[model samples]
Target: MTHRLALLLLLIWSTPLRAAQEDPASAALAAMHQLEAATVALEEAESARDRVRAYTNTIRAYETGLAAMREGLRRAATREVELTRRLSAQEGELAQLLGVLLTIETAPTPVLMLHPTGALGSARSGMMLADVTPELQARAAAMRQNLEEVQTLRLLQKNAVRTLNDAMASMQQARAGLSMAIADRTGLPSRFTEDPVRTAILIASTETLAGFASGLSEIASGDIAGMMASISDQKGSIDLPVQGAVLHGAGKADAAGIARDGILVATRPRALVTAPTAATIRYLGPLLDLGNVVILEPQPDTLFVLSGLAEVFGKVGEVVPAGTPIGLMGGEAPQIGAFLSLSGEGNGPERSETLYIEVREGDSPVDPETWFRTDKDG
Candidate 1:
């Protein structure tokens, strides 16, 4: 009996130890370290072009790592709770088993055998002991499993904290590199001057998006003929001016109940905004309630209005090549707090710094999603 009990204890402890060897958290931790290396590469990039590419790679890596870490933490927390409950139950079972053993050791063997029920009572008691022993052994095995789970969960929690800190630091460095890249480009000449009187009239007379677009169409200066691609041909192939997720697509009602004529993209704070195609800037500055705006006319009949900019680069009527840096988004880095917010995690609010993109064909609002390459379209 003693040898069997010892063997059960050994099996209980060794089984969980072997099972605990398979861990997914180590892979997540390794990815985070790779992201840290990418961040270092971004910081060391020499040219504006290199910096841009490196920054994008680093951001992507950090986002991926952050997501992995968050998932790891969540799974660990759940496992910890489950193991804690199992441990409590096993402890209770152990205490009961110990009490039974103590009672058996204290009571006289003759008393147990010569009870009132005599031989029948002794037979029943022996049967009960035979059943309880296996139950006690099972409970002990469960306790060992719970202990291993608890240890694994602790390691996961620690890794999550370390990864989060590293991600934050990488984000800060990437933000700084983006700022420096923006500052390096200078001397973009304007081809047309802003018509202040006309702009004022348009702002005061227009109330709806369609009206505002029409009003701008009348005052917009610059002949885009032979300078850009045909807008109709580029449908579904054109890239967005900024890299981000589409928060509200065209014809969708925003939180204010206003149906947008364009798409709103939620991006990191101070993210570099670029020209999606070869277009001449027709209008640059604030208009109505929209923040600083940049109007680009890729063709005579097509116009793209980008609003909610914190700063405007290039001058009015300046012709820019495709992917030219135009401006930066408003606010600080990690705009909406953390990458977890991108996945709708936590209670933190969504990013308020949105890039509003409006595409118009001859004064009529067209759905930007139909033309631009959004994630949903892909």
Candidate 2:
């Protein structure tokens, strides 16, 4: 048992340590530090010259930090289980080692050295004990290290509850600040204002998404200005307006067998949706069966239709900059206890909201995936 345990301990101890994956407790600690910075930034957002931009950035930071914390916690939990399983496997051998330590600790040195086989036997036993004593000590020390780590991980997880709660509270504050800032924001140029009467008439006349999109070109009440920067060079590299997984690509049929000319993205609840490029807001509001729609005219003829927003920002005619906050995906934010439960059970955030995206170039449906970067992310 001692030989086997010693070999196992040596194998584990000699394995080269790589820093590719950071220590879990350290990662969680780093995430806590990041959350603290985000909280500080949120406090300063009210006085920022561009409050909208400041709040937007702060919210993004919180989202990132929280995600990191989730990841770090998951890793810690997994590693803790692994260390525990290994230590438990050697419990029997360790119990015997505990007995040896206690024997020497309680008995005098002379009594421990005496052997039933007399002087030479005692000498041989002493030498053998000396050799194995260091191995036993090393095994106990290895077990101690693992025990300490498991205890540390358990304590970190226990304390993570407060950290997560505080981070979530600060995120809510950031979101509120962002909403207020957007309300006070101004100075965005308008290409053409929406004529209420014409838009109303068009909405009543059109039953399909394609027809409504086609009618937008003729419904604007004012003169259309020159187009924004051409994104023709940026094909296949534009960032997705929101962080999500593409549920259905263009023309992909749903369970009902109805295929749409857009991609459906599955996003986590209340995830921020930003403008992918510098574009003029053509229209925003509920339309037909779509819950909420925001149409963007990036160029003269090209339009990007984003549907299913809980709350849309910016006016129909205002030209917003790229990466500006446009809207938020719907669904209630998870409560702290529920979030912790999810962190314990899930691999990542639960995507409970869906966003519909369609791209039209000169009244013709085009593949949005061709223009936007769809690379995988954590």
Pairs of residues at least 3 apart in sequence or in different chains that clash in candidate 2:
none
Whole-model Cα lDDT of every candidate shown, in order? 0.65, 0.81
RMSD of 1: 12.0
Candidate 2 RMSD to the correct structure: 9.7
Candidate achieving the largest TM-score: 2
Once model 2 is optimally superposed onto the true structure by TM-score, how far is the C-alpha of residue 34 displaced, in angstroms?
Answer: 1.7
lDDT of 1 by residue, 1-378 (tens): 133333332332233233334353453444445455545554544333445444544554454444444444444565667778777766766777767767866888777676478788888987887788677666656666678768876775655556567667766676566566555645555456666777778878878656776665456455323553566788888988875778897889998998878988886566667788888887778877898888888877788899999977766667777777677788865532354344234322334578999998886888887788896310
Q: What is the lDDT of candidate 2?
A: 0.81
- lDDT, candidate 1, equals 0.65
What's model 1's lDDT at 5? 30
Which lDDT value does model 1 have at 165?
Answer: 70
Worst 10 residues of 1 by lDDT: 1-10
- Tens digits of per-residue lDDT, candidate 2, 1-378, equal 133333332332222122115798777666666676667677767677888877777777777677677767777888888999999999998899999987867888888779999999999998998898888899999999999999999998898888888988888888888898899888988888879899999999999988998988677886777774787888889888987778888999966787999888888788888899999998899999998899987777889999999999988888999889999889998887777666666555577898999999997999999988776542
The prediction achieving the highest lDDT against the true structure is: 2
TM per candidate: 0.61, 0.87
